[model samples]
Target chain A: MRRVSLLAMVVVAAPVFAGAVADLPSGRFAPLYGLDVGQTSFPVRAFRLDVRPVSRADFAAFLSEVPRWRQGAVPPALADARYLATFAASKNPAAPVTEVSYFAARAYCSWRHGRLPTTLEWEYAAAADETRRDASQDGDFVQRILDWYGQPAREGDLDGPGSPRNVYGVEALHGLVWEWTEDFNALFVTGDNRQDGDISKRFLCGAGATGSARREDYAAFMRYAMRSSLEARSVLPRLGFRCAYDDVGRSP
Target chain B: MRQLAFALCLVSLSAAAQGEPRSVLALETRWRTESGEQVSLSARKGRWYALSFVYTSCAGTCPLTTQKLKRLDATLAKAGKPLDVVVVSLDPEHDTPEAVKAYRARHQLTSAKRWSILVGEQEQLRTLTMLLDFKYSKNPESGVIMHDNAVFLVSPSGEVKATMSSLDGPLDEFVAAVPAPTKGS
Candidate 1:
């Protein structure tokens, strides 16, 4: 076993506990809000995210039974076919697939009778407060993340900060695999500037430009820059996604 | 003298045959270093370079990876085989040249020529990352960027020699895995 010491200077502040909410109804969307100065919101819908990322063992089970997973039949540009997580080899059967692609993730979602969350829906759920408004502002995202990072991450069990907590009554939102959304290309802006366009083309108006306005005014820009770094096809080691369902009550 | 010459020839031939340099498509993108000078991948190909993806605001594995790279750099220097260490920012939005400079200073990476930090346009970085098979994504709501953690070793001839995962490997193993610079190259 290789012993590696991390020089990360993180100060895990005492765990701040919030009041527990009622259990969210199945197939309903919930909001996971951030802690910042102004309004920042991500609306997360309620669906079971595989507790862990797709593991090697989970994938291997699929490989043995599913013909599509075999070598030469698997999708293009997938990482090494042999490496699996050590923890996954001994874990439960229903754990989340960790190192899978957007396509693979979609396949799994399809298999489970669920769909990937739309980008808007995903963001709305992720940024929503306890009441689904911007309790935390855009400017404070980095600090909140830093605060989260400072805390000791709970492992193994699925119900923690990233998992559906008993307190907030929502499922995995942060610190999990960067979840995939359905409408990954939708752009958002407030006031007169609100319009939808090609997210890639709007890079200039998006994040990376600096000003007080950039900080306070251009919330959409920040979101766009953040999402633009991702390739729709690639699956990162840290990237994992959850599934969402349409509101049947509203649709009918 | 004839035997010694024959042995030397055999060694050279084996070294040439054992090293298979894979051609990597290097993109030309301008990045400002801590010193405020513009730099690009094309300019650094003649020397062995170890490149890692990082953002200054990252509180998770980036710091660990940087510390490991710094250790590798120190080890290489002690072994008299120093190489260039380059950190390319995955989050160009927050990781400006000034911010990168502050990050370097925080980690005490002041040695000028051996280490260089860079930040550039997101598109160019995306292109470079694609070519290198590096994957990353950012949460639109929180601005948290998640990326694959791997250090890529590029040869002096602009070829990708090897890649090492940051989570579960010895730095010494990765250091030893790096192919030594060819003599008189």
Candidate 2:
């Protein structure tokens, strides 16, 4: 019985220690907000990212493992009401989970021995267009992404994993749902950018305080704006998340 | 035997007393102090403290925040409250133990036991910040982090009582939130 229990422990512990992830090599990609006037293509460290957004089923497992994270069990400081309501109501565990706050999403990722991808990592992965690594300039790809943004988020589960893989073999970069990055709060826009006088000034300061690196990229601009508008505890109807990891031999 | 049983019952009763929830105090999480000590926030219980997020090298709102905290420290000292202050570095990659010490000395926070300047690995720092509901973002290009400027007032029991955006504003709420000095002192 002792040996059997020990074997069971390792079987359960293996996945917790070695999370499900896909490795991406070290690369460079220009982010929407970080570029200076002339600079482009900032370097990204090699990392592992989840191939798909966390599904309703995946989140249900997390709730079982960490009971404090369930919609009613969570503190108001970490997640507001309406969290995971759609997934709970639909009872369809296969759909991608939505209405998760940054705190809850982050907690879920942490429980899986992973963390949310930084915006740079998320954007860099999204820049791929099924065949090429940098597809920001691809008119058709950009248009398809922009068009998806126009559609209103509907109820019920969308597609499950492994459907829309990118060039990097990572799935569901766009046309599925908006994801929460680890640095969701870091995308700072000056008060002038928000066009709301004096509010942004109260909290933000410093250089590059002006407009985006490329003002023409309205799609990227909208992403940044959405990120900036969120507080840590605010859960949305459509926003969900996945996880990332530092490369195995690299010190985090 | 009777006294020991009564003490055990008292301990369990106190544990059940959830009147003040220290929701943010994940005492198990480890952190590095400015003076290079490794301690948990739970270790600092039994005194009221104020907590804020800052980066030592920040050129923006962080310096403004530090200045405001310095003034609040002095104000509290004069008022006989002499509250504890904790400033955790949002940019932990750059704010090393030695650097955090230098920043503390530079700010002239003399009370070592009261003024705690802390830095931790990114994950631990994130855990604390999430509990405090403080949000921050670092730009890899400019190396500047855009973050929340909220300061929190915590009770002696480790519960966060109130949060203020800027110390430059009216401090009535902050003063009220401050716990009165204990009976002896």
Candidate 3:
């Protein structure tokens, strides 16, 4: 594969009985985007999330069993040109899979009896560190993630350091790959300061920072901007996803 | 040499046509028509149509979109295609049969048999929007919805033939994309 061996180095992940889903508690947090004009934080329900992104080996097996989702078999409307191109290039059994489109990711999660996490659910989990649950404001932590994001992608570069197990024991929330959220295309904000709606025009005038709860959270902004730039059929080399289960009420 | 060249040209043409018809019609959902009749995209497979999304209570741009569709319907009818325009309600939860009927009455579309209004759950709408690459979002508190001001033309085989912004742009190109009416009505 042009991406070399991602399944081996990208995120083997830690062994913390993380195989079982992590039951995240419900809470309200203002996202980088998607808040109403007068609203601050939207309510997030308690949901069970996979501790790590779905890996290449898991996807390879899925492709074998579900031939419809395999390369060339998927409809052009459901996946872009480069969908699953890496799977054809090389085989990395354990590293996380990349180049799966949002539709493909949803199909995969559905095959496992789960669904892609909502943007709020994903952001709520991703905003954590080793000690505190929401380390988004921590300068060093955010800087570390930003540094990783700044790096030019190189083959074999993805092999270690899976964003340090967060408070919820979920790893690779960042510093690995961008993920597909269930409502990734729900919001249609332009990359510039402009957002849709009459209220947004009035409220988000001049700088777009006022629209978000924390204007300082640039990392979340970048993520949201990246998501806004994508279509449901887009597939990228640095994109992967995990699943969330609504059936599991709370972690035991 | 002539036969070889002809065979190669035929190969290319066949290759271009060999793929699943990746269009909105492929997605399956039980959408209730304005008359409360359950129908899916497959029900509209025999003819070409214009597709767009709108809600009855939209205070902002839906009325303009509806007006544009009316013009587009007239232009196509004049062009002899008389393609039907199918509009799905983005706010399926609020747009019940009664609301759809009221919308038809308000728009003076009660007699326009060619215009079909389909109301389905948000789940199917989401799926169809993704396939069409159409964007839409509703603010829970404000009840304000932001959506793409777009319209699409679909072929009888269920593939999108052309697209244009409903809020702007002339219908000349979009009209040209619609297939001519087949023989025998």
| Candidate maximizing DockQ | 3
The DockQ-based order of candidates, best leading, equals 3, 2, 1
Can you write out model 2's per-residue Cα lDDT over B15-132, one digit (the tens) per residue? 2212223356633457887657898888877767888888989776777788878777778888888888888888878998777777777877655567788778888877776566
Query: What level of docking quality does candidate 1 show?
Result: incorrect
Worst 10 residues of 1 chain B by lDDT: B14-23
- Give the alpha-carbon lDDT of every model: 0.51, 0.68, 0.75
TM-score of each: 0.41, 0.78, 0.83
Supply candidate 2's per-residue lDDT for B88.
84
Docking class of 2: incorrect
True contacts kept of 3: 0.23
How much of the true A–B contact set does each candidate keep?
0.01, 0.19, 0.23
Candidate 3 structure quality by residue, lDDT tens digits, B1-185: 23322332333343222233358864566699877788898888878899999999997778888999999999988888898899999999899899999999999999999999999887788778877777777765566777877888988877888888777678999999987876987
Q: Tell me the lDDT of model 3 at B97.
A: 91
lDDT of 1 at A117: 60
Candidate 3 runs further than 4 Å off: A1-18, A88-91, A190-210, A250-252, B1-22
What lDDT, from 0 to 1, does candidate 1 have?
A: 0.51
